[model samples]
Target: MSAIPVKSKIDRDQLLKISPFKEVIKPTVPHKHADYFELILLEQGGGYHVIDDQRYEVLPPTVYFMKPGQTHCWDFSRIPKGYVILFREELLTRECLDVAYNLPVNITLNDVETLPGLTRQFCDDYRAGASPAILKAYLQLIVLKTGEEARTQSAEGRFTPLYYQFRSLVNEHFHQVRKIQAYANMLHIPAAQLNLICKSASGKTPSMLLNERIVLEAKTLLSNTDLSIKEITDVLDFSDPSNFVKFFKLYTSFTPKQYREMAIARLH
Candidate 1:
């Protein structure tokens, strides 16, 4: 099968870019960027955006936060007017990543002008040769402002430090450390307390979260790379290829091969 295209719209030497959305939008295809996070702000919108195998409707005054290594594409029935902000992980803080991790893939805001206003300022500053520090500050403000509009104060506070720490550990070591107890050991908490903290913060058990992360990486490899099933199984640290197929099918209802076929078919 042919490989899915990996787009590098950002310059290799640059970590930040703020540009008009019109310049970037084109006919849709299943593609990914491995190096940067994308923040899309649309003043006018009519489209459907597919991200990581989930479809989201494009609504006006919309904000979409896409992390590194995510697969996405867009089909617009009506043209969208907006701005796109691209920044590398080095430009973000822990709080910014946490906010992005916790929020929905896209947010429809009631106060439309505020985010666009921020984007406009960001664009203006970027065009005026602003320093990296100033650009980083604006980027943080845009993220925090979106977080403010997308969730309540109590909701934001619901996620404790332990919860974030658990997620970080899982993201870093899900392939090697698969058990809730193992994660709890790393966090110095009882497995039951870890479960409770995860469930309380996100309504997902630790096991579910770990499995989800594994499934996500599996899907990424299946759809975006040319790895064989056995190779992917090894990359994911599964003991056997058949077991990996079963695990993927359990969460996604499609085996790795089937998912890859489906993902490749989207390009046509």
Candidate 2:
């Protein structure tokens, strides 16, 4: 079976959801969530989570995160007990939301850590219909803590505002703009300067980072939707389907069709 694109049904006005996994069952599939963020706390479960085509073994007392439109699914050896937290960008505004992205996609917390306590507190606040400000504050703490842990091993000065702005631009326009020079122009810096900034902050050239974003979107469309090769090519703004296949193969070592088949095989 093909992977699915699953959009969370939470209303626009309702910005967050907190649910106990044992009580409220939710969809588990090789799928993509359209326009929200997810924070998962697997307090007790052992399994593998396939997210963005990377396999992460689920260890209890750990938390996982998903950004908008990311493809993911869970394969559990047995039912797991955890808390699922869902929220939209509206809840954090721009500044607060950056903290969320500062974090890596997943984190495993130490058992003695107080993070689990914070997660439990979030559940209580969510159930009591706490004020939006209070709820956002708790989430901010959680998001900040997760980010702090992620940055622990990172050398200083690796994450700067320029790098983050570059990422934001790539996320929004990668399909339309593939040239690193254009990205640098938009950010009002020389192409050489942009490369150096990216190399210092992220250890990759700007072009490499830009192309990765394009490939990621192409993979998501190819794996999670029924769009044909030509349609995917045009959607990604390639000149033709052949170039799309070539680029896909260059990065993935598989043609679009082969990659889709592989993604489906993993799901089953």
Candidate 3:
């Protein structure tokens, strides 16, 4: 008798590009993927979602945004029926990608109680053979609504749309524009005004936010890719490799090599 070869669990891209939507496979136990983002709409299910080392209960009409590189897992023992849309970052429009990727927004969706009629209609459309493009648009709408609702329900209302926009622009262009003045120019606002808006909304200066974004990308590249430090420095538009090293150490307290070693160790 031949032994059965165990297949690895399906990832987000495979689930989206290969699998049929209506076919319900056996429930996936707690699992994580490193390369894909998942936007899930729970039609009917109760579970625990672990994202970025934080755990929350998942209930009906729940919408979640799981970014790449964040560790996420879910337990569906109690309720096992829902809709999961697995998509890659490239699936998003350029504008959506600019907003969603590399920003500091919280990506977990907790027990979302308010389900709008529009979302219900979207779900119905998804079930009724909607195109992937339509599904992506609906998912983006839900994410935007969730953020808006969160801001309205919060006491401080710290995350304004302009703040989000600035943050998105910073994430998308931090490597090229290392100064607040350049960003202000791009956004068509005075540098002082941009600084005031950032300070009012996030309590951080625009320069600080931009540096943080650049440092984050540097760290990601240092850990995930095989690019040399010089190449990385050039890609990030540093005047010199020494200057890039100085900037990286100033932000992270560790040299590039040290940081990369630590990150790889954690994975092992």
Candidate 4:
């Protein structure tokens, strides 16, 4: 079975890089980035961007927040003009990481006037080989502005630190650790309180979130890789392949083989 390709758009030793979107736009395979987060601001564009299993229209003045490990591919109908910022987690503070994780997959910025200038300056600074501190400051400002605009669009409540920590833990251990109570224990909180925090922040129970992560992984593997059902089941840590099939059908209403066939059809 073929494995999904992993791409590292940034350099091995660099913590951050910024460039114009047009500079990097090209044919892309459905792929994952394992080591860095990507922030994109599209001043003008047209096409659909598929992230995991969701497809988003490439609207102008849009900001896309892609966390590490997401599987995505770009299909553009028009040349896109924008900036792409790639940064490792070391460049972010806990607060910035929280915002990054919690923001929508893509946000349409209401005001394009200031953000373009800010991104231009950021691109220029990176080209000049600015110090890490200076680069971090610029990244923080860009995140801050984009996040504020997202808040204005969604008007969602503030995401607490505990919620972000919960998400981080789940992302790191979803395959082996599936129990909500176990996550609560790791956070030193009662299961009941964990439920409250998750509900308030995301409108979903902790179990739902955990299961969603598992389902997303299953979909990514099924869609992008040549793994058979048995191999995929083992990779997901299911005790039996039948159980994995059942679980996947319960969430997605399609068996692994069926999903893979459908994905293959779409690619052609």
Q: lDDT: which candidate is best?
A: 4
Please write out the lDDT profile of model 2 over residues 107-226, one tens digit for every residue.
877543577778888998889989988998887787777766666543434466678778878876777888888999999999999898889977889888888887887787776677
| Best-to-worst ranking by TM-score | 4, 2, 1, 3
TM-score for each predicted model, relative to the true structure: 0.73, 0.78, 0.58, 0.85
RMSD of each: 4.4, 3.9, 9.3, 2.8
Candidate 3: lDDT over CA atoms? 0.61
Judge candidate 3 at residue 211 and give its lDDT.
86
TM-score of 1: 0.73
Best by TM-score: 4
> Sorted by lDDT, highest first, which candidate order results?
4, 1, 2, 3
* 1-268 per-residue lDDT for model 1 (tens digits): 1144679889999889999888344658878786677889988868688887777888888888887666788888788888999888677687876776666678888887888998999999999999988999999999888888778522434577789778778866876888788889999989999999999888889999899988987887786678899988888899999999999999989989999999889758
- In candidate 2, stretches whose alpha carbon ends up further than 4 angstroms from where it belongs are 1-6, 13-15, 22-27, 88-99, 151-157, 179-196, 221-228, 257-268
Q: Tell me the whole-model lDDT of each prediction, alpha carbons only.
A: 0.82, 0.77, 0.61, 0.85
lDDT of 4 by residue, 6-105 (tens): 8898898988889888734475678888768899899887888989977799999898888877889888888889999999878878888777776777
Instruction: Summarize candidate 3's per-residue lDDT along 149-211 as a digit string, tens digits.
Output: 444333432545556567767755666767778878878889998888888876788888888
